[model samples]
Target: MSVTALYTDLSGYYDLMCADIDYREQSNYVRRLHELFGNQGKNVLDLACGTGPHLRHFIDFGYTASGVDINQPMLDIAQLRCPEAQFTQQDMSDLNMDAQMDLISCFLYSIHYNQSIATLTDCIASVHRALKPGGLFCFNAVDKSTIDNRAGIKRQLTHDQSNFSFQSNWYYSGEGEQQQLQLSIERTTNGITEHWRDQHAMVALTFAHLQQLLEPYFEVHILAHDYERIAPWENAAGNAFFVAIKH
Candidate 1:
């Protein structure tokens, strides 16, 4: 499906499908980063910031926030939801902003949307260029090993005023750095069934791979792994979040 159609078709049930994703906790983590690094008079750039849910968290922490995403429908939701922050519909690999920001964040494994290694490196480089000296770049990626071992994972979850029942199925190839996630969600609204599907190709990049690629522009740090949080594999939950400091 076309990118526009993907976002447009799912816009109606997007919120419902993702109501239990715990964006608030993720946002709070970002706010903590801002606090640790001093966010006063600093700007934040949220790359691939879908619906700006995380952007709202940074704004609450007293940082001027801006975001960019290629999906216009999602950007529209973000703009409406967080009018105080600026949201732009732009590709992650070739984002052009006025100046470098203090912090640049690509959260929720959003960086995996880039289907190629070159594009992934370029996306990281673009964020590197968008940050000032000593600026921090944070992002998350899915570990290939975790996806290969686990697929067809289902969970029944509920949110405020809504119910989220989803099956997380993914295809991962151990031979290369390519993976696909099919998030099949069924929402119950007043006992009615509403279904939505989000197919995402989550590019897998090793910690060393990214660190080597970003060494020229950033001092990379592997913050944490998704160990025991999502799957049974030791240190293999398909999510490796890291922070890199720009020189």
Candidate 2:
């Protein structure tokens, strides 16, 4: 399926469906990670910065913020949300920036969009090259174990004139190394209903595998859960957060 089409359909309702997310708190946590692991510079880049809520927070906190995403519709919304920052249309796997950043963040498990280990490696390499020496990279991912354990889930929401519903299911293929998230969405606005369905693929990587992949270009600093610092193995919930520094 075309990911661009899926996101284009979702762009208008993205923030509505994600109303539960506390972007301020999440951004504060990202800032804290930068303070703990970064070089204390103000230049920051947000990868896959959909709708720019987190980027707006970084800007509010006085960072020289910039954002990049593959979807132009999403970038359009982001540009409106944070006019002070630059927004670019680019894929994470082949990101190019004229200036290196002091910190780079890919939040909300956006790294999983790479869909394959080879592409994920390319994405990480791009990020490494985009970061200045001692710069920090922070991201979160769903562990393979977590993907293996997922069950079918459903959600519904109503915001203003739009009503939204989504059903999600998970599948594993290729001897459990690849995971897929199947999403079915229905949106009704002003009494007009639209349906969209898409399956997104991700390369399931264990904490050790991800660490090994990054060790070549970055100093793996922390692997925790839910933004709290903890041992990687202790994260029974399958949500993993990572902070690394470019060597």
In the order shown, the candidates' Cα RMSDs to the true structure are 4.3, 2.2
Q: Give the alpha carbon lDDT tens digit for every residue of 54-166 in model 1.
A: 88878887778999998888889988889999888898988899888998988867787777788888887788788887888877766665565454767676665667676
The digit string of per-residue lDDT tens for model 2 on 77-192 reads 99999999999999899998989999999988889888788999999999999999999999887777556535777779887768889776666653656777777888899889
lDDT of each: 0.73, 0.83
Off by over 4 Å in 2: 2-4, 149-153, 174-176, 189-193, 228-235
TM-score of 2: 0.90
Q: Local error of candidate 2 at 238, Å?
A: 1.3
Clashing residue pair totals per candidate (backbone < 3 A): 1, 0
Candidate 2 scores a C-alpha RMSD against the true structure in Å of: 2.2
* TM-scores, one per candidate: 0.82, 0.90
Off by over 4 Å in 1: 1-6, 37-41, 152-165, 186-197, 225-238
